[model samples]
Target: MGGRFQSLREPVFRQWFFSSVLSASGTMTQGVAVSVLVYRLTDSGIAVGWMTTCTFVPLFLFGSYAGALVDRIGPRRVLLVTQTLLATLSGLLAVLTATGAEQMWMLYAIAAISGTVSAADASARQVYVIDLVGADRVSNAVALNEIVVNGSRILGPAIGGAALGLWGVWACCALNAASFLPPLIVVLRHKTKTVTHPHTQKIGGLRYVWRNPTIRVCVLLAAASGMLFSLNVPLTPFTTAIFHLDGTGFGLMMATFGIGSLPGVLLAAAGPSRPSGLRVAVLAVATGVAILATAYAPTVTLAFVGVAVTGCASIWFISLANTLVQLESDPGMRGRVMAVWGMALPGFSVVTGPFIGWVGGVTDARLGFGVAGIAMILAAATGWRGLARPTARTPVTSGASRA
Candidate 1:
């Protein structure tokens, strides 16, 4: 137990992690408010979908560029600027909401801005954790990072809904705007002294990903997870068509999946923080099987068990892959690597939801889950040899290596 959280003993990571939890919670809360508000304003579900799209599209478009920027400018500098920009953007949203000047076009513009900021922020914050903790605890830190993100995701919506009911959307926006303060302050006051390396040239993120077999596997897994675990699209069919249940039943299935993730992450954290290809492969395969079981369950009660198992396997795969990417990449190019790596999530978000829904629409919801499981199984097979091989990684004392 003590070993699982040894990373928290580092003061920088402790503060940063604590601040990130609150910031992420606020961000999620604001997301709920934005979605609800946009739907109300436009009275269109499609419009709301577009609003969500606006928030993720920038990463798919310019994520690599943003990451390269992080490496050149330094992650700390990037975080300081990006944090302020996001806070100001949140404030701008509040102003627009309160002043009755909010429009669909304006909301979209803000979403796009938020997405762009998020792209830079993702790479910066990820690479900065390396700067803070060095090599030894990077895996633990990455696992902890996932816990914060997933935990906050689970809570943020409910909190945002309550705020919306009591104080309204503007209040949610305002509170979200304020939520950025702790991290911003923490970053601003963060001081580090480290040796510098003279860089003669820069390497493209994709080039490194291609050259490194481990990183390539990690990225593939990341991308594939996005497509496979897009299980939400098939839930309606599973609940209504298969289980003959109501909306509340559908919510139960979703919540069970989310609840299951907590244990998966915790288990991963408790284990080795170091990259293990076998672990990733096993988890991927297990997740696929769980998806199949959930799809073919004889009863709703059994389906919940499958959902929970799927959740546990999903996070285990993700956190392990993320840790591998961080550990394997050269510190000099970590930002670009993480940037390219981060795109996997959003990439699938845009494509898989509707694609999976269509699969369920054409065939049965069970088949869609089966197909996703097969895809995952196939993807895992490709990495079996690579993951089975033991590889050595060099640890860094500073954030970067000397040239």
Candidate 2:
């Protein structure tokens, strides 16, 4: 155990890992706080859904552009700017909530601005990991990133909720805003310089992805996963209404999913390099099945178990796909390619959020979950053959070649 722990203590991994943890925790806390705040103020499922939509819509509209920017400018500078912007926005939100001047529209506007910054930031960070850890350990690094994200999911909501209970929502937002400092400081302090990709032109990355069959299929699979998994957002209303639980119960349920995700990350970390498309397809099907099972769960305990299963499947699918993208993409185009992947995930969420909310408002939240499951299964079935086929691999160019 000591040896294993020591291996991750290498300087490059340590910096990236610590930065990832801080960013993930802050982001998770912000998500929960925003969702809960919107729900409390509006008491409408659609309104809460709108909050989520506003937070992601920018990715769809500006993802390609953001990718181009990351490639041209380098990841380090982009991340620094992103961290500063996020901290400022989060602080503004904290102050607004504290003063009781927080309104629904204000929340929406802030979420939109934050989401725009996040889109560029996410693309940069995804590509930056390659610089830190080298290509050989990309899968392990991706898995570790997942672990950090899940750890935050486990702790962030619980902590945010506690802060909300003790000192009001403002406290949670304040802590989240403050949490950005560690990563920003780390990025600013890094002595090792980042190298920029040669291609600064806007359309190059998009053209490359359009021409690559494997990358295209991978992006589609990710988008489908995004759409299907959106059921979780609206499902919160059902759990609260059906199980007669409160915000604390919602936090605990999310924590349960986080618990199940840890093993999936470890599994990915241990696996050898292989084309991940087929693996992702299989995991997508499994996730859909798990969601279907979750819809039928009659008790909170059973529902939590179902969510745990879904979480494991979801993590495996997403981690494998991410690893494949990072491994197979042209280094010059990686930032943009990753931006496309990030866009698909959040972009689908923006469109699906209101629809899922509508479904829950009209009938039952279980119906939303069931429908999403079916959609995911259909998507997986349609793409199975394409995803399974072996394709020519792209060689890395630019600084990534050094790895």
Candidate 3:
């Protein structure tokens, strides 16, 4: 077990990891609350979808630039600024919701503001892990990070739901607002000698990603999967109409998805550090199958089971993709590469969020969800040819070699 978690040997990473888990749990709780709150306010899947769209629009727009910025100045400096801004945003959100000043537009505005900050924060966080743990433990560190993400899904949603039901949206938002403190303190107190790469300009990252076949495929795969992952946007409708549940039910439903990823995280943590195309292709198919199962499930219990399966498969797929991209890219170019990775992951949702919402609005949530499942399968099949080819491990340092 100790060997499995060798990354923890680094004191900086250890502190950052635990603090991040607390902050992430709060973020998850707030996320559940925000979804439920939007649904209650507007009572439309499309409205909830629009909220998601608002959040990712900034990520889509400025993600690449943010990555170059991180690479130039280093991730630690960027994280310090972004984290503080995010905390302030959360606080502002709590105030607005608490004072009954939250309109749909207000929520949208807040989400957009946070998303803007996250454009830089997300890449900073991704690359900062490498800084803390070094390249050797990158795979384990990334898996553990995924665990923080999915594990928070377990606690955050449950707490968010109960708080929303018992207290209100403000309380849930407040909890999330408070959650940022630990990570902020950790970032403030921690110090590292981050090397700045002057040559890592904005477009350089894009060119690097475009030239690298493995990374190119990874970006494409991440973007394709984004459509299916946007299922979170319509989860409110799924809880209310499909499952006939309230806010608490919605929280549990989200929690089920988070809980399901535990097995996948364990598998990835124990698995190889170097990523394989075949492994990624298989996980993508499994995720699609799991999503389809959840979509067609007749009973809520069965739906939860299917959701759990999807969560497990999806986490494994994403963890592998993240590791592959991070490992394959040059250290100096990592931020830019991960920035594009972020764009593919959550940033691409700017398009899919609205589309999924529209689909659920016009048709049924199940059908819309089924469409995502179909998209995932098609994407995997399309990318299979490129992904199936074995990528030889070589010390790829610069733009000199396109291999």
Candidate 4:
């Protein structure tokens, strides 16, 4: 298990990891603030869905191109610039709220901009981590990465909820704006020379992803999970409407998911660096079952428990897939491969977010859960062979060449 903590021993990773913790907390807080703000302002579930779509649709359209751009430019340069742009967007949001001039259209624009820039960071960071931590520790590093993310997931919402309850929506945006500073500064001061794997064009990224079965399957499965999770847009509204929960209750509910995810991440970090594809499939299936159960949970208490299990399965499945993809791909193509994932993974949100919100509006929120759960289960089943198939033990490439 000592291996699980190996990446932390590196000074650079330690710096980035700590910064991500603060950043994640602020981002989660902003997430809650944004959801509540939209719901309160419009009082329409569809509007909430639109907000979610605006936030992620850009990812679907720009993900592959952003990844290719990262490869062409460099993760360091890309992250520094994206962080600055996001911080500017968040600051503008704060101003809009402070001036009482915030509009639904303005929110949508910012969400789209934020999502577009964030997509680049999401794709590039995976590649960046490999350079920072080296290949042998990649699995452990990814798992540890989840721990920071999950840890923030655990605490960020509750804090966001508290901030929303006390300070109003602008506070969350302000915090997010401030949170970008550290990462931006860290990237600016970082000293290591990054190894670049330049891709000539964006079209090549799509073709490479299509030609590789393992990468292809991982992206598809990730998209399935991403769709189910995208229900996050409506989760706040559903809890308030059905469970009669206040802000604190909603925060607690979100935190409970972190409770489940924390252990799952640790288990992944502590286990074998290379977990089996069969294992990933099993976890995905379990996540599907958990989501289905959560949908029909008779009470809030049951729903919390179900969400916890769902959270656990979700993290393990996604993290394992990330490890496998990072391990399997040639480093030269990895940025593009992850970019394809960035594109496909959130592609579901463009449809699913609004669709689930509509379902939540027309019938019940649980119906949305049913739809997502069934979709995931079916996806896992159909892809089981591809996910479970054995593959050659490819050496982890360091961009130069694979052993």
Candidate 5:
């Protein structure tokens, strides 16, 4: 165990670990704060759905462009600007809520702006990890990042729930917003570094992805899997509707999922260095199966257990898929490739949010969960061949060769 632990002690991994811890905690807190605030103000399921959509829609719309920008300007500078903007946005939201002057539209507008920044920020962050750790340890680094992020998923919601109960949503938002300061400060203190990439023909990142068969398949898989995974967003409302629960119940459910994800992260971290695409495909399929089982869970306890398994499988698939993308992409186009990945990851949710909500609105929330699971299973099964094949090499320019 000690030897295993020591292997993760590289400087780049250390930096990535710390950064992920701070950012993940902040993000989780922000999620709880936003959900509680919107639910309180509107008390409407659709409103909550829209709030979730607001966070994801920008990623879908602008993620590719953001990736291109990350490559052009470098990820370090991009992180500085986006993290600062996110912190400021959080503070503004805190003030609005604290003043009792908060309106629904104001929340919507703020969410949209924040979402735009997140798209770019996320792309830059993904590419930055490769630059920080180099390609060799990218898989381990990604798994460690997942561990941190999911760990936050465990801690942040618990803290947010307590804060929301004791101090109200305004205070939670204030604290959540302030959480970004640590990462921003950490980024600012680091010296600027150059990221080299191969100069490729300027094309939309999504277009570039479409041209690569393996990448294209992975992107499509990510999109379908993303939609399935996102059922949790709407699942909160479903739980409330069925169990007649409150914010605390929602928090507990998220916490349960978080708990389940921790072991998955560790497992992924401890797994083989080079993971095959088939492993990722299997994980995706397993995630869908877990969700399918959860849909039939008669008790909240059973549902929690089901979600926990789903969390484990989902994170494993995501971490592996992400690792594959980073490893296989040309460094020059890495930012764009990651952005394309990001776009597919979150973009589908934006379009599916209202649709899922409508599904819940029309029939039952479980139906939405069922549909999402089925879609993922079908997608994985269909794309199995592409995913199973080894990645093909593309011609690289001199700059890309160095990268």
Candidate 6:
């Protein structure tokens, strides 16, 4: 197998990869449509913030336990259950929307339900990457997955925007509900055996993360950088208010961000397999600056340019951090560790998402962007030392790494 795209050479992984792209496309489309729907219904940034909070609350609450669960029973089982629940929830949302049920409470309810399943699904999916491609090609596999995520960002929003213009929000929701089938079918067809970890010591995933310096830094910085990364909340108002654009323009704005991420992902895939702390820090700072620039961008073109740069930097930072944590973790504990990663990044969004939204609501989306930018810069400045620290060879570290 070739080095850069070696993960794709695995037949199972290849199939899983394509299936995930199809699934993620619908997921991404629904996400954009939902945001637009919320804005259209309430016209409030605070409402958008609350929707984000609802979506992430489950991850914030149960992410670590979800990871431990994945490690205990294996990712395959967890994915099977979660995906089924997600498909049901998407279908439910579609039904409600079709019936003219655009109430805030209803949207929040569905988001909470979907978020709950995602708490496990996200962790399982990360572990599933290792399961499909093995540990050796984990970095390459992760990079490819990032492409799927960001690539879907491009495709989903464009399709969603068009769908919204033509068939309405219900169509996007229905599309998402249907989109779950391909991945479910793929999971059903893929025959990876379950391997449970029954004898491992009872260490909490958070505690383990605290003990590992490299992972600890990666997670903490991820938490700190999350506020800046919650672009969707502010982007809602930024697109409509600043750009004065409709659904298509909003979709294009998001698609441009995804577009920028591809080159960065490809570049990372071509580089050394190992992740670098310096690169993470640099990208964090760059992400902040780009976001700040976008906040102040006077024209629509400049705002698009700014977000594209922010997307490239932000995704690069996240991908590197993910690779670092995965490579540093023990095979037995990888799921739990990644769960912590999930918490630090997405779970933390519960707080940042609302706050950013409120800022956009009260002041301006530009000011919200400024706040995120400053916070990111400060996080990188303070966390750089810890992030740059080399892994020490303590007994705990040695034992855990070799586990």
Model 1, range 1-403, lDDT digits (tens) per residue?
7777878888878888998998899898998999988988989988987887898889878888888888777788889989898989998998988888899999999999989999999999988887787777777888888778777877788889899999888888888889899998878777654323336136788888888877888787777777555556678787888889898888888888888988877777777757687888888888888888878999889989998988888887888878878887776777888998878776556776677777888998788666677767888899777766775574654642212
Q: Lowest summed lDDT over 10 consecutive residues: which window, candidate 1? A: 192-201
User: What local lDDT score does residue 160 receive in model 5, on the 0 to 100 scale?
Assistant: 83
The prediction achieving the highest TM-score against the true structure is 1
Give the Cα lDDT of each candidate. Answer: 0.80, 0.76, 0.82, 0.79, 0.76, 0.80
Q: Rank the candidates by lDDT, best first.
A: 3, 1, 6, 4, 2, 5
Off by over 4 Å in 4: 39-43, 161-168, 231-253, 293-304, 357-367, 392-403
lDDT of 6 by residue, 246-330 (tens): 9879878877887888767766666556667777778778877888898899898889888888877877777877887887777
> Clashes per prediction?
0, 0, 0, 0, 1, 0
Q: For each candidate, what TM-score against the reference?
A: 0.94, 0.86, 0.85, 0.86, 0.86, 0.84
User: How well is each residue in 1-403 modelled by candidate 5, as lDDT tens digits?
Assistant: 4322333666544755676686677677767887877887788978987877788888988888888888887787899999889888888988988889999999999989999999899998887766565565567778877777767867787788888788887787778677777777656665445555436537778787777766777787788776565656568766787767798787778677777877777777676655777887888788889888887789888988988987788878777888887767776787889988888887777766567767777888787676667877888888888788987553322211111
Task: Give a tens-digit lDDT track for model 3, residues 193-241.
Answer: 6666877574577789888877788788788778666656668777788
Query: Which of candidates 1 and 2 reaches a greater lDDT?
Result: 1
Clashing pairs in 3: none
Best by lDDT: 3
Model 2, span 45-102: residue lDDT tens:
7898677778788988788889888888888889889989999999999999999999
Clashing pairs in 1: none
Among residues 3 or more apart in sequence or in different chains, the pairs in candidate 6 whose N, CA or C atoms overlap within 3 Å are none
Better of 3 and 5 by TM-score: 5
**In what order do the candidates fall by TM-score, top score first?**
1, 2, 4, 5, 3, 6
For model 5, give the 10-residue run with minimal summed lDDT.
Answer: 394-403
Model 5 ranges off by over 4 Å: 1-8, 165-170, 197-201, 233-253, 297-305, 360-366, 393-403
